[model samples]
Target: MLNYIWSAIVLLSVVCSIFLGKGENLSAAIVDSGAQTVQLLLTLAGVITLWSGIMKIAEESGLTAIFAKIFSPLLRPLFPNLDKESDAFGSITMNITANLLGLGNTATPLGLKAMHELNELNGSSDTASDEMIVFVVMNTASLQLLPTMLGSLRQTYGSNAPFEILVPVWLSSACALSVALMIAVGLNKRKRRL
Candidate 1:
């Protein structure tokens, strides 16, 4: 569906240029766009490679374990039923860390593992547990402390200050995560009362 939409957009642009008597200019733009695309991809590749390597180092050096320990107290309230020593706890910590860095690609596998662990804790129940719901909301909210992906995109597109949006991103993400948590908690309380 998206491929069709993109194709239509490209075709429309070319047709419109011809109708506007800008067909000759369109040829130059098309050539320029290809070069720009290559440059952008190269820039993005370097940034992604650096982040991936950093994540691997953090994992190997037990930095994530230390982080998990530090964040466990907060996790207790958010996931009351999760066993501290369980695989779910570890997977959840790693997933959150990945999200915090805005590394969605790295987060995906960790999120999947966390879901698997959550299912295990649910005692094979068909429905999701409260903790699982919270986890999903948190993932969706995605409160990024360091939005590397966005920064990289900005840099690729030739922004002068790529990471200047960090504060705004944090502010918005915090608000979103807070709202989601409130709604999830309210629903859970109402469910329990029923």
Candidate 2:
């Protein structure tokens, strides 16, 4: 469905360009679009590599483990079904840590793994458990200490201070995350009442 929509949009744009006697401009636009995509991918790759390497070092130095331990209490209520020392907890912590650092590309695999583990604990069912829904909400609204992706985009666009958005990002993310968690908890309670 999305593919068809994109195809229609491109076709319409080309027709409009032809009618405007600017058909030649379409080729330039397409080339520029492709170039921009390639540049974005390269930038993403570089950022992911740098963060992933730092994460690996942190793991080797036991920093990741320390963080997992520190956050275990908070994570317990969110993932009550999982054992406190489970690998899922570790993966979830690492994933959240990566997200807070704004290394989303690096966090994706770990998040998937955490979800997979959570599903396994649920006997691999098609339906989502309460914990799974809560996890989704938490991940979606995870607080960010560093808005690396946004900073990268700002830098790419030649912003004078790419990292200047830090304080606002931190405050907004914290509020959003708090609200998301509260909503999830309320829904869970309402489900129990039903």
Candidate 3:
């Protein structure tokens, strides 16, 4: 569906450019944008590789375990029914850790693993459990301590202070996470009453 939409957009652009007698300009813009996109991808790839390696080191050195321990207190209430020693909970912690460091690509697999484990704990039911719903909400409202991807993009585009968005990111993520949790909890209670 997205591919079809993009193809239609490109087709329209070409038709419009021909009618406007700007075909050469359109061609030049397309070539320039393609080159720019490749350059941006390379830059982002390097940043992601560097951060992924750092996260691997942190994991091997037990840094992630320490982080999980620290975060457990805060995450406990959100997933009250989950056992601390369960694989689902552990995966959830690791996923959150990856997101906090702004390693979203790395976090993806962990999030999926967490969800799978959560589903197993739910007895592989068709319906999502409260914990599962809350976990999804939490992941969506990911709180990043370092917005590495955004910073990389900013730097790639020539920003002097790429990480200057830290405070605003924190404020927004905190508000989002807070509100999402409240809503998830409220809905769960309401559903139970029905």
Candidate 4:
């Protein structure tokens, strides 16, 4: 579907350029944009790689374990079915820690593992469990401490201070998490009542 959409968009753009007598400009734009995209990706890859190594070091140093310990209490209520020291809990902790540091690329695999573990806890049900929904919400609205991806984008784009949005990002993510938690709890309770 996305492929079709992008193809349609490119076809439209080519048609428009031809009718507008700007085919040459469009040709130049395509090459230039493609090069720029590659350059930006390379820079972003460097930033992501650096952060991934840092996260690995943190994991080796038991830093993620510390985060798991801290988050365990909060997770208990949200995921009552899960054992306190379950593998799911460990994955969740590692995933959230990576997210907090803003290494989204690093967090993806952890999150997938966490979800798989969570589904096992759900007994492989067809429908998503409330805990699964809550976990998804938490991951999606993940509060970032570092905003590494955004900072990297800003840096690549030549921003003077890439990480200046740290405070705002934190506040927004906190608010999102709070609201999502409230909604998830409310909906779960409502489902129970019905």
Candidate 5:
């Protein structure tokens, strides 16, 4: 569906450019945009790689274990079904930790691992469990403490103060996470009652 939508958008853009007598300009822009996209990807890849290494080191050094311990109290109630020592819980902790440090690219694999672990715990059920829905909501509206990815992008684009958006990022993410959790929990409770 998304592929079709993108194809339609590209087709529309090409048609508009031809009608507006800007085909050459559009072609030039497309080439330039591709180069820019590659440059941006390389820059982000460097940042993400650095952070991923740090996260791995943290894991090896038992820092992530400490993080899991710290987060356990807060997460326990939210994920009551997940055992504290389970692989799913560990992946969730790592994913949440990566997100808090603004390592979104780094968190992707962790989130996937967590979801897979959750699915296994769910008896390989076709329907998503309450815990799975809550976990998804948490990830979707993850609160970032550092916004490192955004900062890296801003820096790459020549921003003088890349981290200046910290307060707004915190406020917005916190609000989103809060609302998402509330809705997910409410729905889960409603499902339980039914």
Candidate 6:
């Protein structure tokens, strides 16, 4: 469905360009778009590689473990279903830590592993459990102390103050996460009562 929508959009743009006698401009834009995409992919690859290497080093040196311990109190309530010493909890902690550092590309695999472990603990079923729903909600609204991706983009665009948006980002993310968690919890309770 999304593919079809994109195709339609491209077709409409071409038709509009032809009618406006701007076909050459459209062609130039298309070429520029492809070039920009390639550049973005290369940039993302470099960033992901650097962050993943750092994460691996941290894990091997027990830095991740120490951070996990530090953040355990906050994570405990969010994942009450998982045992404290379980691999699921560890993965979730690492994923959260990566997100907090704004290393989203590095966090993706950890998040998937955590979800897989969570599913296994839910009796290896195909269906998502209540805890899974809550986890998804929380992950979606996970807070970030650094906006790494945004900062990188800003730097690429020659921004004078890439980190200037930090405070607003923190405030917005906190409010959004709180509201999302509250709504998810409320709905879960309602479901249980019914």
Per-residue alpha-carbon lDDT of model 6 for 46-120, expressed as tens digits? Answer: 888998898888878877778778888987776666687777777778888888887778889888988999999
Quote model 2's TM-score: 0.90
For model 1, where is the 10-residue window of minimal lDDT? 47-56
Give a tens-digit lDDT track for model 2, residues 89-178. Answer: 777888899989887778887789889988988889998888788888888998999989889989987999999999999999999999
**Highest lDDT, which number?**
5
CA displacement after TM-score superposition, residue 161 of candidate 5 (Å): 0.6
Segments of candidate 2 deviating more than 4 angstroms: none
What range of 10 consecutive residues in model 3 has the weakest lDDT sum?
59-68
Deviating ranges (above 4 Å) for candidate 6: none
- Off-target runs (Cα >4 Å) in candidate 4 are 1-4
lDDT of 4 by residue, 126-178 (tens): 98888889888889888899898888899878999999998899999899989
Cα deviation at 122, candidate 4, in Å, is 1.7
Give the per-residue Cα lDDT of candidate 1 at 98.
84
RMSD of each: 3.2, 1.8, 2.0, 1.9, 1.1, 1.4
Q: List ranges where model 1 is wrong by over 4 Å.
A: 1-45
Displacement of residue 145 (Cα, Å) in model 6 is 0.6
Ordered by TM-score, highest first, the candidates read 5, 6, 2, 4, 3, 1
Model 1, TM vs. native: 0.77
Provide TM-scores for the models. Answer: 0.77, 0.90, 0.88, 0.90, 0.96, 0.93
Local distance difference test, each candidate: 0.86, 0.87, 0.88, 0.87, 0.92, 0.85
Report the C-alpha lDDT of model 3 over 58-110, residue by residue, as the tens digit: 76887767777888899898888998777788788888988887778878778
What clash pairs does model 4 have? Answer: none
Clashing pairs in 5: none
